[model samples]
Target: MLSLSDLRQRPLNVLCAGDVERHETTEWANSDDIDVRNRFADLLQRAFHA
Candidate 1:
């Protein structure tokens, strides 16, 4: 598991919870979750609007 501090070292816009989870189980490499992509897009939109 990646510590919060490790995740914080990079730009938040390019990282998400799944990236850390992938590091643990390596299953995300085959993930097809559109919801995650939508969430990231939403976050990016919010950041840009702010």
Candidate 2:
């Protein structure tokens, strides 16, 4: 797990909470649930807007 301080030290555009795996492409690698995806989208929006 990454601490707040650790995250603050890096440049992060989006943060998703789930079991993620490395993928060959740039596609999503976490949960496929609609709710999860929606939340992730919201987070991504906030990240960029902030």
Candidate 3:
């Protein structure tokens, strides 16, 4: 069977992509279809810095 060490060896980029996808989904749900995507971008930056 695979060991815990093997799991830890998984690619880091995969984890990052999951986080990015979830963030996009959240922003889309809270935003309107007409406005610019800038607000979402700004919110993400603020959240990261905070």
lDDT of 2 by residue, 2-48 (tens): 22223323354246354434332124326667665565566566767
Question: lDDT: which is higher, 1 or 3?
Answer: 1
Record all residue pairs in model 3 with backbone atoms less than 3 Å apart, i.e. clashing.
Answer: none
Worst lDDT run of 10 residues, candidate 3, spans: 1-10
lDDT-based ranking = 1, 2, 3
lDDT of 1 by residue, 1-50 (tens): 33223464467535665544323222332347766556555645676786
Candidate 2 deviant stretches above 4 angstroms = 1-30
Q: Distance (Å) between predicted and true CA of 47, model 2?
A: 0.3
Q: Model 3, 1-50: lDDT tens per residue?
A: 11112223456444333322223446544666534355555555676786
Collision count for each candidate, in order? 0, 0, 0
Error of 1 at 26 (Å): 14
Candidate 1 lDDT score at position 42: 61
Candidate 3 all-Cα RMSD: 11.5
Give per-residue lDDT, candidate 2, residue 8: 27
